[model samples]
Target: MTIQSAFAGIMEAIRPLYDAREASNIAHLVMEHVTGLGKLDRIIHKDGDLPPAQEALYQQALQSLLELRPVQHITGKSWFYGMELTVSEQVLIPRPETEELVEWILLDHPTQPAWRLLDIGTGSGCIPIALKKQWPAADIWAMDVSTSALAVATRNAGIQHTPVRFVHQDVLSPDASKVLPSLNIIVSNPPYIRESERTGMQQQVQAFEPGIALFVPDNDPLLFYRRIAALAKEKLEPGGKLYFEINEALGQEVVALLVKEGFEDVRLKQDMFGKDRMVRCTKKEAAPADTTSPS
Candidate 1:
């Protein structure tokens, strides 16, 4: 079949799930991946016949798309901060909002000669990998509980050529302190979606992505945030920063928890959609001892 015919098949297969324009876009991206063609080449050669192998690959991708699997998963890779990172069902696909979190950290500490950063529940290791790229001199560490997820993240770190210390430990466990380390900055984009919200999410996400990387109990939506914040209270250096990519609904609750933990300069910020998706705070400076107390 011609390239146009393959694209038509993709569009027809996806029409029920995606809008017309979006279906066309997905078809084009799949074609680009299969044929290794640039946008202009695809447009210019729309009438050209697709090789049998290329057509077969496109058909397989179309089937996966029809089942609501994410394109990133079908492609086995994703782009974050201009770096191509490998991904699997074991890891949550890196989202654009997380890029904003990385950018915020970089923007805030551009001139620091060096600093230490810890990324909790770092699924694909995107946060630390991206940060290491921006702050080459800084020490970076990432922790995640899923061994499968860490495997993908480790491969991505090598691919990006960014050295990040990847630790295997559950950040929520009662005995998790042994894996913890004090740092100048702590950032996390942990599982914040409530189980109640699962029904409302896209089937592509609900079915294909790792549940542990995406959800928390509705009754305790701040599960990860509270634990990470409490850990930060113990591990963050004085005047260090804590950042989170939060569920928009729990922005204020997260800020309140940080304040309760004695974080200073707490801020709740919105993403491009104006939803409160990010919260950041500074560790309060240590109080000085009174001179009169000297013996």
Candidate 2:
């Protein structure tokens, strides 16, 4: 069958399950993954024929799409901060808002020699890998509680040739300090979504994505933030920065929490859609004491 005919057939098959626009997107994503043909290229090669093997592959991809599986899972890859990273059900798919957090960090701090960074709950190692790629001289460390997730992250780090120290440790545990030293920057896109909120999420997310990496108990929505912030205060050097990809619904509460924790100049920034999606703040510098008090 011609490439165009196969593409049309796949889209039509999934049309009942998704809106027209979403069906088109899924069709394009599947085609790109299976045939190495982008949307425009597919149109350009509409009349070109597909071999039987390629056609079979396309059909399988379409079947997955019809089940509403995420395109990244189907392709086994995801693009984040200009790098293609491997992904699986074990790790949370990197989101664009997290890229905003990375941008805020890079913009606030000038790259310097010997700068050390810590990424808590480093799902796919997106933030640390992006930082290492952008500032090769900076020292990077990533920690995660899930060994399966760490395996995927480590593989992506190697593929990207971005050197990072990956440690399998639970950040929520009380003795996190034992795992690493103080850092110049601490960043996380920790689990902030409450369990009750899960009902409102898409099927692709609620059904397929790992729950531990995406949720916090409704009663303690700020659990990870509190633990991470306390650890940052102890481990971060004076004047070091903290960054987070936050839930917009709890922006005010999160900002207040950080400020009360002695973070100075705490600020919430909006994403492309004008939602409060990122936060940045610095550890307060110590005040110098008077030296000539004795007479």
Candidate 3:
């Protein structure tokens, strides 16, 4: 089949599964991956015939797309903060909003020579890896509860040549604090989506993504946030920063929780889409104990 025909066919086949724009985008990704052609080259060779091997690969990718598989899963990688990281069903696909959270951190500490940082629920190691790439002197650690997810994250961190310490522990566990160290910064994009919202998510996300990385109990939607904040309270250096990519709908709730936990300078920031998707705060220095004896 000609390049033009193949691309058009893939789009048409998946139109029912995705809208026009998304279908076209996925078709373009498949075409680029299979043909090893850039968008401009694809356009220039629109009518050129696909090689037999390319045709076979295109057909197989089209089938997966038709099944509502995420394009990144088919491509086996995703771009986050200008870095392409390997991804799998084992880890949640890094999202652009999370990149914004990283950007916020960079903006706040643009030129720190040395700092210790931790990322809780570090699926694919995107946040810590990206930060370490930017701040090489920073000591970075990432933890995840899922062993398979940690394996994927380890591979991505290796590919990026970012030396991030990976820990296998659930942040919700009481023992989790025992393994972590006091740090200058703590960040997390924890499970903030309520289980009740699952029905409204895309079929590809609901079906192919790891539920452990994406959801929280409906009755306790802030489960991860509460636990991670408490841990940060105990582990963050005085005046150290805490950051989170939160549920847009729960921005106020998360801000309140952080304040109640004694975090100061709490701020909720919006993503590109103007959704309240990120929050940052500072840990207050401890008060000196009463030195004067009572009469």
Candidate 4:
């Protein structure tokens, strides 16, 4: 069958699950992966015929896509921060908004003197991997509770050759604080979604992605944030910063928690969509004491 016909078949099969535009994009990506051709080449050679073997692969992908499986899992590759990284069901697919968070970190701290960064709940290690790309000389570590997720993250770091330390530890564990080094910047994109909200989430995410990486109990949505913040208080040096990719509706609440935790200079920032999706705060440096004394 012609390449053009294969794309049409795949698009038609998945049309119920995705819109026209997204279906077309997914078809192109699947074609690229199976044919070893880029998107432009797939477009330019739209009329080209596919061999029986390649057509079989495309058919398999079409079947999966129709079931709402993410294209990244089928392709075994995802593009993040301009770098191709490996992904699987073991990790949550990296989102563009998290890239915005990484950009904010780079923009705010363009240059630093030997700073260390730790990313909690680091599924796929996308945040710290991208940060390490920007600051290759800085110390970077990322941890995830799942062994499978950590394996995927470790492979990504190896492929990028970024030298990030991948730890297998849960942020919620009692001894989590003892495992971390003193950090100059502690960043996290933790699980903030309430379990009750799962019904409202996209079918693709709910069915294919790791649920542990995406949700928390409704009664305690800020569980990860509170735990991580407590650890940051002990692990962050004076003037060190804590950054989070926060839920839009809970920005003020997160800021309040930070304030009650004695964090200073707390600020909420919005993403391109104008949602209060990013927040940051600093551990205040101690004020110098008076040296002069009465005679």
Candidate 5:
């Protein structure tokens, strides 16, 4: 089949699962991955015949797409914060909002002489790895509950040469905070979606992505946030920062939780789409000791 034919075929097959623009985007992603052709190049070479091997790969990808698989899963990779990271059902595919969170961190600490950072529930290790790339001098660590997710994250760190420390520990467990050194920054894009929200999500996400990395109890949607914040209170250095990529609907609740937890300078920011998705707050500095000899 020609390039145009394969692209059109993939788009047609996935249209039932995605809208016109999204279908086209998925097709473009698959075509580029299989053929290594840019969109304009694909257009220019639309009639060019696909190599037999390329055609076979295209067929496999198209089948996966029709089965409601995410394109990143089909490609076994995702781009986040300008770096390509391996992804699978074992981990949540890193999202663009998380990249914005990373950018916010970078903007806030550009001149820090050293950073001791930890990313809780670091599924794909995207946040810590990207931060390490920019802050090579930083001491970076990542933690996740799943061994499989940690393995994927480890491989991405190796492939990207970011040198992130990965810990296998459940953030909910009391001991989760015990293994970490005092940190200058703590960040997480934890499982914030309530179980009830599952039905509202796209089929590819609900069907193919790992549930352990995407959900919290409906009664406790801020489960991860609360736990992570508690841990940060113990593990963060004085004046350290905590960041979260939050569920848009629970922005106010998260802010309130952080503030009540004694965090200061709490700020909830929207992503490019204007959803209240990212938050940052500073750990309160310790009060100074009294110096007067007589009171």
Candidate 6:
């Protein structure tokens, strides 16, 4: 079939599953991936016929779209902070908010002559890889509890040519000390979504994404935050920073936790929607030892 005819057919097939705009987006993404054509080029070459094999691939993509599978997964890749990373069911799809977390870190440490960064729960290595790309001189390490997720993350690291140390250890485990050390910065987009909130999420996310990477116990919504904060206290150098992509609803409580931990310059930053989405806390500078004897 001709390119125009194939595009129209695919859009019609997926229209029932998504709104017109979203369906159009899916069609464009699939077409671009299959044909490597920019939007203008695609329009200019609208009369060109798609090969039979390419037409079949388009049909398969439309079918997956109808099933509510995310286009990123269907495409097997995603762009984050100007780098493309491979994605799979084993990893949580990188979100734009997480990119903000990376941007904040880069802004905080604009020139790290020899920086060390730790990314807890580095699913897909999105945060760490993005940081490494932006600050090529930084020493980056990432940890995850899931082996499968680490595998995907490792592959993406190689693809992006961003070297990141990937450790296979659960940050929440009692024996985490052996695997962690003092670092210049600690950042995590940990699992903060309460289980009770799952019902409200879209079917695609609830059905496809890894649950362990996406959820927290309802009774302790700040479970990961508390553990990571405590670890940062032990491992982060004085004046180091901790960044998190937090739930907007928990912004106040998160700030309270950070303040209680003796973190200074704790601030909540909003995402593009103006909802509180990220929290950045810097450790207080160490006080000088007393020189004079107490009376």
- Assess the local accuracy of residue 289 in candidate 4 as a C-alpha lDDT between 0 and 100: 91
The candidate 5 region of ten consecutive residues with least summed lDDT is 106-115
Q: What is the C-alpha RMSD of each candidate to the true structure, in Å?
A: 1.6, 1.7, 1.9, 1.4, 1.6, 1.6
- Model 6 has a clash total of 0
Per-candidate count of clashing residue pairs (backbone under 3 Å) = 0, 0, 0, 0, 0, 0
- lDDT string for model 3 (163-198, tens) is 999999999899998988789999999988899999
lDDT of 6 by residue, 1-295 (tens): 8778778987888787788998898788888877778889989999998887887787788777778888888889888888888999888989888888887777877765478889999999999898888888888999999999999999999998989999999988988757766798999999989998999999889988899998998899999999999998888899998999998889999999999988999999999889999999988889999899889
Clash pairs, model 1 backbone:
none
CA shift at 219, candidate 2, in angstroms?
0.6
Q: TM-score of each candidate?
A: 0.95, 0.94, 0.94, 0.96, 0.95, 0.95
Candidate 4 residue-pair clash tally: 0
lDDT at 54, model 1: 86
Q: After superposition, how far is residue 79 of candidate 2 from its true place, in Å?
A: 0.8
Task: Name model 4 segments beyond 4 Å from true.
Answer: none
Cα displacement (angstroms), candidate 2, residue 269, comes to 1.2
Off by over 4 Å in 5: 40-45
Per-residue lDDT of 202 in model 6 = 91
List the lowest-lDDT window of 10 residues for candidate 4.
106-115
Per-residue lDDT tens digits for candidate 5, residues 1-295, read 9999998898778887778998888899999999998999999999999999999999899888878889999889899988989999999988888889999999997784477999998998899899999998999999999999999999999999889989999989988888899999999999989998899998888998899988889998988899999999999999999999999999999999999999999999999999999999999999999998995
- How good is model 3 by TM-score? 0.94
Clashing pairs in 4: none
In lDDT terms, how accurate is model 2? 0.89
lDDT of candidate 6 vs native?
0.88
